[model samples]
Target: MLNYSFPLTAAIVATFFAAGLVKGVTGMGLPTVAMGVLGSLLSPLAAAALLLVPSFVTNVWQLLAGPQFGMLIRRLWPMMLTIVLGTVFGSMLLTGGRTELTTVALGVALVIYATYTLLAKPLGVSPRWEPWLSPVIGLVTGLVTGATGVFVIPAVPYIQSLDLDQDDLVQALGLSFTVSTIALAIGLVWHGAAPVGNLLTSTLAVISALLGMAAGQVMRTWISPQLFRRLFLIFLLLLGLEMALHGLLRT
Candidate 1:
């Protein structure tokens, strides 16, 4: 049996609860909150690994169980491919000796991404540009995942700009996170971060995330799509700024 100190246990519970609500209401954000809080306490490597399992599980629920599966698959396939390839490329970079720097970069990117999410305008008017734009988002998300085990926020605006209804948006976001989580898991194994002895924590996170999702579902009816968009972006901004300052000063 694995045991966490009381405070750590409480924190994980809280983190997962919040992560779930974010996922339920918006269709993503589980690992963002998890990594942000956990990265501060554990080695970035460990925190990253710990986040992988729950994220994978949560995305399964969002992508497969959601209402827009077929539509999302058709619309988001190109971006999904980019995410897969980019994460692989990023993970390969960690094969040698870039662990520490990757951690720092991870923290910094999280902050920047968070800030960008907050201030960015409505997405550009052209889906025609998305094919070109997607790879960039995918590449950055992959690099950040490789370095700090986080990604998603950098890709949010792109997804949001599509003006997907809630179900469609969640499906896309869920697919993104699910694919990234799978890629990161492979990367972690390559780098020896897998078979991590933290399954207990991961299990706890999953449960909390599910509960959070349920709660968010209850609240979802009350939240306008516009409100969801504004709140989500604002939250990302604050999260990003917090990460930036923390990473800069920590080292």
Candidate 2:
């Protein structure tokens, strides 16, 4: 069992709080932000374990906030199933003493996600292509999530491209995130990385995240969405660079 000093506990709370604030303002990024910060101090799998419960609860709230739950689930089932399977396979590898590779992979994933956020315009996908593309994206995203515990790259962008109404889009993201979180949790447990004792700390993280989310909700009305997004992307870019450098140098 790992020991948690006062400073470590404080850092974890602060990190999750900030991550949740970003999620509240942007409708995404809790895992991304949490992983980026926590990965610096802990192994990728450990960081992932810490985030499981908080991500699940918040996403559940987001998922239930809209009315198209059944519709979205039906349309996205193939992708969801593929995500789960891919995550299982990837988790097996991650738990097999591949921490260094997983850290590098997380860094690369973050850089790619940040680059896309900075450069990509809003894309629209034709309905005709959804059947062919959704499963592929889901599989890739699941693999990435299983290895690195970050699930927002290809999945988030693909969902955004669907051009659903704002409510549906939010709900879709929530559904995807909720599923991904649960799947990741299961993966962690399967790998023996997530123990029952972690649940207490995870619950504390949930509270901090919720408080931060409430504060961010108030700030959302004051901040312009475009500006907030740009700032968010910039932060991710810096964090990604740091993680990549650290991982490379350490290796």
Candidate 3:
């Protein structure tokens, strides 16, 4: 569908598998990992298209797997709605010709979030602030997602501030990412960034991603998740830096 060569298609499949493996091991980072890798070669819009199915399917499972879905829905619905609104209003940045800008934006987003993850102390949000702050964060996160195809800046931190238990936290991420993915997919479709033929390719990528997740589950028994997560973040930081610098130089 993308008209890439055999080797490139193989590489994309491998990329998806690896991304899904990270999600299986870390319970997050599939889109982050995949977009950081794919964005270097493809337009952010194309990478976003390729990411839709795997991200949605996996996150849906993650969202449903936890015990607090109904409660989270009640609590986070406003943020979710705002993410959609922001995505629709901002999708033009992604679908337009400013490929380098989007790539740079994607790279910067990765660096900021990864650094925050590795260095930032845990933060808390007052319950009094959630009513107003959550929607604002969602709007910004959605705009960033619409412009750059990455969605883990204020959104992730906002979710963390809620101080959820480990299980609920994971499920919350799933819901957040699922909303982002669905909204992004709609934007892409609305602008013809994802053509009908691309669905076949995206669906195939889902298989590779699931297989990678299975492999990761097996590997999870052999090593420490904390170690893997640390290593993964460092890798992401470096990749983001390289991508950003490359974008800057090209401009």
Sort by lDDT, best first.
3, 2, 1
Q: In lDDT terms, which candidate is top?
A: 3
- Clash pairs, model 1 backbone: 111-240
What global local distance difference test value does model 1 have? 0.72
Tens-digit per-residue lDDT, 14-82, candidate 2: 999998899889888899999988887788887888898899999999999999999999999988988
The C-alpha TM-scores of every prediction are: 0.82, 0.96, 0.96
**Residue-level lDDT tens digits of model 3 in 148-180:** 788787898889899899999999999999999
Candidate 3's displacement at residue 203, Å, is 0.8
Winner on TM-score between 1 and 3 is 3
Alpha-carbon RMSD, each predicted model: 3.1, 1.5, 1.3
Better of 1 and 2 by TM-score: 2
Q: Clashing residue pairs, candidate 2? A: none
**lDDT (0-100) at residue 99 of candidate 2?**
71
Q: Write the per-residue lDDT of candidate 1 for residues 1-251, one digit (tens) a residue.
A: 14568887788778778878876776667787777777666656666767777888888887797887877777777777777777766766544455455545656666676567656667753877876777777777776676667766567767878777877877788888888888888787876766546765676678888899899888889987558756765665565565556656655
Query: Any residue pairs clashing in model 3, and if so which?
Result: none
TM-score, cand. 1? 0.82
